[model samples]
Target: MNQNYSKKCAPRRLMTVTALAAFLFAPASASLFAQAGAAASANSPAADSARSAARAADPLRGTPSTITSAGNEARTQQDAFERSHRLGLRFYNGGADATCEVALGRICYWNNNGDVPPPAERADARLEREALLEVLAKAQRENPKDDWVNGMRVRYAIEGGQAEVGLEAARACGGTDWWCAALQGLALHNLNRHVDASAAFGRALAAMPEAQRCAWDDLTLWLDPAMHANYKALGCSGRGAENARVFRLGQPLWMLPGNDLQNEWYSRFTMSRVHSLGRLPYDMQWGDDLLESQLRYGWPTAWSVQNGGAADPRPPQVVGHEPTPSYDFMAVPSGIGSPTQATAKDWEPTRKKARMRYSTRYAAGYGALPHQFARFLRGGDTTILAGGYRLMRDLEMGRAPYTAALTLDGFDGRAPLQVVRDSAPANSALLVPFSSTMLASVEVLAPVGKRAARVRNTVSPLPRETRLSDYLLLQRGDPSPTPTLERNATQAYGSTEIEGGTTIGIYWEMYRQASPSAPLQVSLRATRLGASFFQRLGSSIGLSKALTPVSIKYNDNGRPDGGAGRSLTLNFPSVPSGDYQLTLMVSGAGVTDSTTQVVRVNSGNK
Candidate 1:
C-alpha cells in the first residue's frame, strides 16, 4: 500500500512539473490555443445574433432593405441620440462647460441619411434646435463676452432665416469685423434696407482680407442694384465705367485687333462731356490733352478727337485715309443706313454735293465733317442718295465685279453690313434702313481682280512665263502654274527652297493693251505661316504696308502699238527661316491680277 501511494504521488508531482516547464519555455504555443478557442466562440450563431442586435442599435449603421429594417434603423438612431445626450450631460456635470455644449450642439444638428422619413426629419430638426438653444444658454452663462460663441449664435440665427436676430448677435460680436459686417449687410439686404446694406457691404469690403476681396466684389455686384445704377450713371468716368464704356462702343469696333478703339472712344466721349459740355460727372483726368494723346497714340502729341470722326465720333485710330491707288478701286461696304426706295439717278446730285463738301472741309483743314454736317449727310432721303452715289462711282470706275444693278433691299441697312458675293454678272445690292441714325459713308467696294486683267504663268518651262489672257491666271507664282485653259505644258516644278535673306527672281509676262506711259502698280506681300486671321484680313483690305512696293513703267512712248508682253523683278526683304507665301499684285489701267507662290526659307544653304 505504501508503494502504491508513493507511485501516485510521484505521477502527480511529475505532471505538475511538466506543466510548469511548458508554461515557461513554450508560452506562445499556449497563447495560440487560447486565441483559437476565443475565435471559434466568436464565430458561433449566438455571437453573430448578438452582434446584429448591437448594429441595429447603432444610428451610424448602413441602411438595410424592408420596413422592419427601416424601423430597426430608426430605433438605432434614437438609441444613439440618447447615448450622446447622456454623454453630454455627464461632461456637463464634470464641469467641461464648453466641451459639453459643443457635444450637445453636434448631437442636435446631427445629419442623418436623407432617406429618413419626413416625420423623423422634423423630429430631428426640433431636437437640434432644442440642443442648440441649450448650448447657447450654457455658453451665455459661462462666457458672455466670447466672440466665437456669439458668432455661432449669429450663424444659427441666419440659418434659421431670423435676420433681425442674426443682426443682434453680430452686433454683439462688434460690427467692425468683416464677417460681422457681411452678416449685417445680408440681413439689411433681406430687410429691404438697400442703402444701409450698401454701407455695410462697403465697410465689409474695407475690412476684408486681400485674398477674399474678389469674392466680396462679386457678392456686391450680384446683390447691389443701386451700385450698378450708380456705375451706369457715371458713364465713362466712374470707378466701374470701363465696363460700361466697353458695352457702349458696340460690337463692330470690338472685332478689331486691340483695345485702341475702346480707349480712344472712352477718352473722347469723356472729354466731350467734361471739357466741351461742362458736364460735372465726367472724369477730369481724361481732359488733359497731353495725357490723352499719350494714352491714345503711345506718344506725346496733340489730342484730336476729329481724327476718326469721318466714320464715327470715335473711329479706329489705325484706320488710314491714304486711299488705295485709283487702279485698286475695290469698294468696301460702309456701315451707313440708306432709304430702301432710293435709286442711283437720285444719288448723282448728292454725290456731286458731297464731293464739293468733302473738298471744302479738307481744304479748310477741318479734319472730318462737323457733327451737324455729318448728321445731315446721314439724314432723311439723302442717306440713300449717299449710298447710291458710292455705288454709281464704283460702277463708273468699273470696280464692281458683278454687273448687277444697285437695288435698295440687299443692304442690311445696319452698321457692319454684310455684302454677299454672287456669281451673277449683274451684281446688285439693296440698302434697307432700319434706323434713321445712320453712320457716315458706308462705302461698298468690290474685291480686287474682280474686273482686273488676268495674269497667267507656265511652270514646266524653267523661269515660268507669266502673261495676260481672256481669263485670269488662276494660279500665278504657283510651283505648278496650270493655265485654266489647257494648253500643252510639261512637268510642274516643286516649291522654291531658298536661303533666308536671298532675293528670288519672279518672271512673268503681261498680255494687255497698255499705254507705254502708264505706270503699273505692283505690290509684293510675304505672309508667314501661322499668321493671325486679322493680319491676313488687313492685307486683303489694302492695309498691309509691310509688303514691298514696286513700280514698272511700260515704255510704249517709242512703240505706238500697245505693248502686250512685259516682265518684272521684285526684291523682297530679309525673311526669317520658315514657310511663307509670296503674293504679287499687279495693277494697271483697267487691269489687275495677283499670283501666289509657296516659299520655304531654309535655315542654312543646302
Candidate 2:
C-alpha cells in the first residue's frame, strides 16, 4: 500500500505555453485546497490581498477553506452531506482532515436487499441521479460559494455524459483550489482537451501531500506481476517526459483516437479517491477487487448482471462489475523497448505478442490506417525519412486536409532525431532529414476525429556502409498521370495496394557498385505472402505452384555515382488475389543487397 510515489508529485515548475494560455479561462478565488505561495505568507492585510491576487493567476492557489451555505435547505443539505459520510468513515480511513479528495458520488447501494437486481427488474439509476442534480442545481444558485454544492453538480455532469455541464459546474465552484482544478481537469479530459486537462491535473497533484501524490504516479497498477516487474524496472523516474513516453507506448492501439491512457491516469485519481474506502465481502480490504480489476484491465465500458440462476438469489453475489467484454487488442508499451533494447531492428512479431499480455484492452478501438515509409541516404551522413500516412475511409469524412507528422525518435523515445509535418488530403506524406543509425521508432500521427490513429514502427537504421538504401515503393496516385522517379512524400501510396492490373514503381539506390557501366547481377522475385502455414510449407518444400513465383534476373552494367537512386516497376501477378511479397536483390563485384515487402492485390485472378 505504501509506495515511493509518495514523493513530490513532480520536480519542475509548470510552464504554460503561450498558445495554450490563449484558451484558458479567467481564474477565480480558491477555497478548501488553496495556497497563496510566499505572497500570502506575509502579515494579515498584505496576506489577504496577496491571496486574492494569487487566485486570479492560478486555479489551485489561494485562501483558506470556509464555504458557508445560506439559510434553510442549503444548510440542512450541508449537514446531511457530512452525516451521510458518517457510515463511509467506518470503511474509508483516508481522512477529511487533510487532502483535497472527497467522493462526491454515491458509492454504496444500501437497498441491495441481499440480492443482485435481475436485468428485467433493474431500474435506471441515472434517472434518480438526474432528478437529484435538478435540486442540486437550484441549491448551487442559492449558495454560489458552496464547494459541496458545486462539486456534486460537476460529478453528476461528468458521469452523466454532460461534459460541458461538468465544465460549467467545475468553473463555478467558489474555491479556485484543488476541488476546482481537479473537477476542471476531469471535465476538460472528457472534452478531449488533453493539454488543458493535463495542466489542471498537474495543479491538483501539486496540492496533495507527498504520499497521496506518489500513489497517483504508479503506472504498474494495471500490470500483472511479471509485466509490472518488467515495467517498473524500466526506470521511469516519474519525470514528465519519461511518463509521456511510457503512456505513448502503452496506447492499446496507436491508430485509435484520443490519449485514452493519459486521460486514464487522472481518471484513476478520481476513482481511487472515491473508492478509497470501498465496502466488500472479499476477505481483503473492501474495494480491493474493484481497484485490482480496474488497475489491471482499465475501467470496463459496460456492465450487465448475471443472475444467480442455479444458486440461491439471497446475499446477491452478482454485482454490476464487468470488464470490457469485447475481443480487443490491448496496447502494451511499444516504440521504446526495455532500457536494454534499441533500434526497430531488434523488434519482431514474436516479441510483440509476448509483451501484449500487459496492455489493457478496450472495445470499439480505432481501425488501422495504411502507411508506407522508406529511408534513403542523404548527403552521406543524413538519412531522408520519407513516409505516407492515410486516414482510413471511415475517419476521412470531411474535405478539410488532414495533418500528418513524421518523427524519428531515439532509443529512449527521448529527443526526436527529426520531425517533419505536412498536410494533404486523406493521404499525406512527410519527408524528414534524419541522421541516426541506432535503434529508433518512426512515428506518424493522424490526429483527427473523436478517436484517431497513431503509428509507431521501431527500427534499426540500415548500416551506413550497406550496398543499398531501402527500396521505396510507389504508385501512380491521383493527379499524377505518369509515375516518375520524383515523388511527393505526401502523395506517395504509403502501402503497395493496387488493382492486380496496375503496376507499382520501385526505387532504390545501388550503393558502392562498380563503375557506372560495370556489369552487375540483379534478381527480382515475387512470392506468396500471408499464406496459411500449410501453404507456406508447400512453397518451402516445392509441394505447390498454384501461383507461380514471379522471377526476374538480369545483369546490369553501371558505374555508380554513390548509387544514390535507381528505378524499376513490378506489376501485380495473375493469381488468386490476396497479398504477395516482392524481393529485389542487386549484386556487384563483391557486394550484394536485397529488400522485400508485401503488396496487396485486390483483383481476383484464376
Candidate 3:
C-alpha cells in the first residue's frame, strides 16, 4: 500500500467500523428494515397492477410500458442505485456504495423520513463520509499517481468546502485533467484570484470535448464576469468564433425600431452567421421573441400603397396579403394612366407586356418574394435590369400587373392564367423566365375594386419615370401588428379610444431626399388636453409650463428610396380618463415634419 494512501485510510477505517456498529444497532434500523419489507410487498402483483392502471390513466405517461415481471426487480434496484448515488453526493447517506443494498435501504428510509435526517440519523451521515473517504483512499492506493483519481480527490475536497485542499490536489494533477483544472478554477475563483481562475477555466474548456460541454459549462463562463471578459478577449478563434464576436458586438444594436428591422439586424449578426457556420439551418432559425411580441401586441394595422396617393391603411384582414420586397417602386397595370408615365416606343410596348407575363410566372413558381430577389441578385436574367423594375412591379401587385397587361394583347386571359400554376419550381433551374411565346398568348386581366380604377388611371402605354418619395400615416390599437409583411399592416382606427393601461399605436412614413444610411431622428409626444388652467397659472407666475409634452426619441435608418417609416406604440405613466393630443415629429436631411391626432381616453367603468 502507498504510504500516503495508508495514512489517509487509517482514520477512515476506524470511523467506518464505528459507523457500521451504530448503523446496525440504531433504533431506526428496525423501522428501516420494516419499511424495506413493506417496499418488497408493494412490488407484488396487486400493487403492480394498481401502478400499471395509474400509468395507463396518466395523460403524460411516457411511451414505455410498465414492467411488472422479475425484470421490474432489476429496474427497482437500478433506480435505487441512481437515487442513492445522487443523494450521497449532496447529503451523507450512511457509508453505502451507490449499488449497495444497504445504500438503497438508507435512501428509501431518508425519503420516507421527509428528506430531513433526524438528530439520531446525523451519525449515519458521518459514517457515510468516512466510508467515502475509505473508498477513495483504497482507490488512491491502487493507483496513487492516476490523474483521474487525483482529479476526483480535488472534486471531493471542493465539495467539502476545503478550497485550499482542493487547489493543492488539483495542482498535483498538473492541469492535464479537465476536472482538476475546473476544481482549481473554482478554488481560485472563491479566493478572488479571478485572472488565475479564468486561465484555469479556459484550460479546462480546452481539454473538454465539445459534445461533453453542458449547461453548467455555459453558466460558469457567463456568470463569472472575469471569466467572460477573459473569454471575449482571447477565446474567439475557432469555427463559430466570428459569430460569437458579432453577437457580442451587435446585441446592443438590436434595440432598433420595428421587429422586422430588429430581426434583420439580429439575423445578420447572429442567425445568418450561425447558419453560415453550419451550426443551425437558415430557414429554421427565429428572431427574438420579445421583438415579435412587441410587433404583435403593440400595433395591429395594415399599410397598403395606393396609386398616386398615400397608402390606404386598413385592418389586417381587410388588406389581405401584400408582399413588400427590399426596394421602393410602384407598378400600375396596363391601360391605366400614371402621373409619371413615359411615352412608349413601338418595341417598348411589346417588351413591357412581355415582362409583366414573366413576373407573373416568377411569382407563381417561387412561392416567396425573397426567392425572386435572390435570382435577381445572381444576375440570372441579364435582360432584366439589376433593379428589375418589371419584377418589382409584378412583386408589388402580385399577378395584378401581369394579368392586366396581358389582357390588352388581344388574347383571352384563361390560357395564360392556367400556366401560372404550371410553371416549374423556382429552385428547379438556375434561371427561369417566362418564354416569349408564352407571353405572346397572354392578355391583361384587370384587378378588382377601386384598385382597378387606380391601376387604369396610373398605367402608362409606355415606361414612366416616377419618383418614389411619398408619405404614409397609419394607426392601430394597443397591440402591435404581426411581424410578417403580409400580416403587419392593419386597418386604421376610425376613432381613437384609450382605456386603462392601453397604449396608442402611431405609424407614419416620411419621404426625404437624404442618404439612406443616415439616421433620421423621430420623436413621439403626447400632450394632455384641458391646459387652460395651466396656461392661466403660467401667465400669472411668468412661467410657461402649459402643455408640456411627454416624448420619446427613436433613430431610424433612411429607407432605400430616401424614405423612412415607423410604427411605435406609446403608453403614458399616468393618463387620466380624458382627451389628449398625440404628435409624431420626424427630422432628417435639414427638414422636419409633425402630425398630430386627437384621442379620447375613457374611464374603466365604460
Writing each residue's lDDT as its tens digit, candidate 1 over 162-255 gives 6676667556554236655655555554444445655665676678676555432221221123345544455332434333222222211111
Worst 10 residues of 1 by lDDT: 1-10
Q: Which stretches of candidate 3 lie over 4 Å from their true place?
A: 1-127, 130-138, 141-148, 174-179, 205-536, 539-606
Query: How do all models score by TM-score?
Result: 0.20, 0.62, 0.23
What's model 3's lDDT at 215? 25
Predicted candidate 3 versus true structure: per-residue lDDT over 300-405, tens digit per residue: 0111111111342221110001111111111222211111231121112112111111111011121111111111111121211110011223333333333212
Q: How many pairs of residues collide in each model?
A: 25, 30, 32
Model 1, position 567, has a per-residue lDDT of 29
Q: Comparing candidate 1 with candidate 3, which one achieves the higher TM-score? A: 3
Report residue 364 deviation for candidate 3 (angstroms): 60
lDDT to native, each model: 0.31, 0.48, 0.31
Candidate 1 all-Cα RMSD: 33.8
In terms of TM-score, how similar is model 2 to the real structure? 0.62
Where does candidate 2 have its weakest 10-residue lDDT segment? 1-10
The clash tally of candidate 1 reads: 25
